[model samples]
Target chain A: MASTGAVTFWRSAGMTYNAYSNICAAIVRNCLKEPYKSEAVTRETVHFTTTNWENGIQGKPVTHEIFK
Target chain B: MAMAAMRREGRRLMVISPTVSLNSTNAVRSPLVSQELSLQGTRSISTQIVRTRMKSVKNIQKITKAMKMVAASKLRGVQVRTEQSRGLWQPFSALLGDIPSMDVKRNIVITVSSDKGLCGGINTTSVKVSKAINRMNSGPEKETKYVILGEKGKVQLMRDSKKDIEVTISEIQKNPLNYTQVSCLADDILKNIEFDALKIVFNKFQSVVQFLPTVATILSPECVDAASETGGKLEGLNSYEIEGGDSKKEILQNLTEFQFSCVMFNAVLENSCSELGARVSAMDSSSRNAGDMLDRLTLAYNRTRQASITTELSEIISGAAALTG
Candidate 1:
């Protein structure tokens, strides 16, 4: 009985530790470079051509030349 | 006698068992309830944070989408220019390759990031890469300097480093990477210090969701050499060698200038894509977290209500029994 109880406790503790470690690792990975990449891409895509909002045409033009 | 003793022991144990269980249960439950309440408090705080983050994420998404549309619109023009410039770089690189004994003394890294926040880890990753590079160059043989393109990069570097920082240009407009800006930055770097290698660190846009952090070597005669060698191989295969003059130094200078512009253009595209992806993901997580908290809170509220009702019923039954007695 005693041996069985000890085995059960050890198994539960190990499982909990593994779960916690996995969660921490995931949080670190998700919060790191991913956000920066997305932001950088968005900025590049939207603002690459328009330098000044006042002078540049607002909204994408439908019938503009494909290349300058 | 054995049966009588056994009966007494069994009764005593039975009596002791409930008391033990009641005490133990109370002991366990008190802490568990306290922990539950603490969890509730944390959940509330997390919910508030999620709400604020959601708002910000939505705003960023709007901006990113707008930016994506803009990039799509301008991509054709940028692609054309880039393709045209590739032809010009061929002869230039062959010249630089021919000159084997050029002096290389220092390395300078120009890091481009955004002035704004909420785009995500684009700036942070760039800064981390820069720090790693700086640490690598801490050896006696090499010296590294920084030319920052965004306010965020400047702020991050300033917090930890006390090295020689050259120019910092912030609030760059979203224009087709102006050759003039690249030239000005290049001229400043060239005039101020003698560097053997120049690297431009920025995000390279692969897709809306994937932006790769790239370290492009902008001012290396080695690039021209590689281009020439590659060009020669292609020409041999197709029966045409690249037509260009033998002024390797002049060609190298021109190639370096063109390389700077390409690096800038690539960086801008990458950073914008990264920004959009971060905002979309952040918002998605926020909405899911909010839903989870609401479910947990509803369960706790129901459990507490049920416990109170059971207590009231038990108290009324005990009062009625006392009255009957």
Candidate 2:
């Protein structure tokens, strides 16, 4: 268990280890070199399609894109 | 009058003979039709089979080509991320010296694999390595359990060693990999199982053509303490001073968890890169083989078609000769 010491401020802030580590990783990614930084940032983008179904009839698909 | 009557009889005989010959030819034509049935029917059937086979092979070739392209592009992206993520775990590895030969009684092997297959023998290689580790570590006092990371490994490992598996985590690659996600996964594994040490099995990306299955070990804080007390590889840890006097255990636990996540993230990235690379090569070979198969099938199809055409032409010539003579 990680204690609420100065070393683990992220945990005290109600962030899980994953979230803290992800923030750290994101910071590192942002600090990368010019071309690699942009490439890494863009690579995290996800594209998916969503459609609604009502009464066995499908609606038009909508594309959703998110960057994490 | 006798000559005319004789000519009329001859004409009548000619007409009756022609009609009898036509009926006799129709009777004989049934056997020719059977011969055509046996020869041309089989020939056309074979030709149709070859044509359909060629079509399917062509479709497979197209699919493989597209897969190869997709894999190539993915490989480039993963390769870049792998290189970048190397820095994330290198410091931890330096701080926590890797003791590959360290013997631990309770071991948990985390086998890294991918959800999708067709990436050569990478999953098999990792699974084999995991099994070998289990064999090597099996003893009266030693216990080993598996925590498979992907569906590919789960399917491969479940074939024989279902009992050894502790937990199998999938969908790790469902989204783009990041340190946060890997850390969360590491946290989940830490919460679930109890182990003296964790042996992470994964494929190391050596190059575009080479992937090496590797096992990296991370020791629990207690194990680290034990190792340091024994004055072995971790002897240097005793020299470092802790700022917070009573919080040493807490600090060590945090360090161990962080190190585990870092190493796991790197392993995941490296494995993904290797998978993509392997897929690219595998699809390349598949499409090439499909092209070769298509070529052979096309040759057979053309040959059968030409044979059928030749047979039809010979039949036409023979029938015409019979009609004229």
Candidate 3:
């Protein structure tokens, strides 16, 4: 959720927030291992899934700064 | 009156000689000429049909040629980008792989494919990889869930694993896909009920000629703990230490979340590259086939025309011979 300038999110023409969050939510669930689904873990995931990330996702290809 | 008759005879002879030459050649040379006599009425229609067919084949070749060029250029762009971003996810996956899991019950798989067809068997291969993963693990019903990211994969899974498909995402192929397109899927994943681990089935772009379906697993921290706890060689675990309170768990969770997205993003890119490469080769072959078809059609057209000419000559020469004899 931090503005690390690493991840930039951009939505296409008609993509809904619910749809976007659903994908993020799926990623979190798939990555979250069992027993680690603790209260703290749930809270951390809620932060990433339900935020305004439309500022930047760098949809373009990155070749120069890849090594940096 | 005699002079006028002589002139008329010369004119008649001029037309008669060509007919005689044509019929005699067919009669003396091959039986293929006799068959032309029976088919004389259909020659015009068949030749017209052949011309239209050749035109359509030429048009299709043009389209395929354009597609191949576009796919090749797109492949070049994505391949380099995927290679650059490879470093972001490779280490995390390596660390996760070494870690073992305690609960291997719930399996969540993301099948990466493109919405577009005509790309060989890229989508089919991904679905097969997913099915193979399910079979290998012997995943139980309702326990193994699927998130399909492309229309082609969704259609394939809908028939058999319809119940297992939890979510389907689209619009990636509408533009050049990037991490942002993947973030939407990642966001959906974070809101899930529960899962032990995650796996993504994608087509790995081996080369222009070979694309192998691949699956990459995203491990949870519990699995990592399970590995280190069971003495699965915590070789480099002690090196990185967390000093803060619950932030330690929080940080690890965040890292895993980010890494998970990165892995998903990488898979999408790899799959896109494979799709384009497969299409490039697919179109290449199709265009080549069209060319071969055009060649065959042209040869047939020429043969049909020659036969029609032979039939005309046979008619003319026989008429002339009857008149003289």
lDDT of each: 0.53, 0.80, 0.68
Clashes of each: 30, 0, 27
Candidate that scores best on DockQ: 2
TM-score of chain A of 3: 0.33
Candidate 3, which segments miss by more than 4 Å at Cα?
A: A1-68, B1-45, B98-103, B139-142, B233-235, B245-247
Off by over 4 Å in 1: A1-68, B1-103, B173-194, B207-209, B220-247, B301-325
Error of 2 at A49 (Å): 21
Per residue, candidate 2 scores C-alpha lDDT tens digits across B1-325 of 9999999999978866764676577985556555654574464445656677788899999999999999998888889999999898888877777776788999988999988999999999999999999998889998988888777997898778877777777666767776556776676678667898899999999997799999989998788878888998888888888885446666677788888988998999999999999999999999999998888888877877888788779988987886787
Query: What is the alpha-carbon lDDT of model 2 when measured against the actual structure?
Result: 0.80
TM-score of the second chain in candidate 3: 0.81
Where does model 2 sit among the CAPRI classes? incorrect
Q: Which model, 2 or 3, shows the larger DockQ?
A: 2
Looking at model 2 chain B, report the run of 10 residues with the lowest lDDT sum. Answer: B36-45
The interface root-mean-square deviation of each model, in the order shown, is 24.7, 10.9, 14.6
Order of all candidates by DockQ, from best down to worst?
A: 2, 3, 1
> Tens digits of per-residue lDDT for model 3 on B1-325?
9999999999988866775677787565334445555566675455888899999999999999999999999889889987787887888866655232334777778899888899999999899989877766554443677777777887888777765666566665554555654555575675543566788889887888798888777666555555555665544554567764433344455556677778887888889888988999999999999999999999998998898888678867976775587
Candidate 3 residue B74 C-alpha distance from true site, Å = 1.3
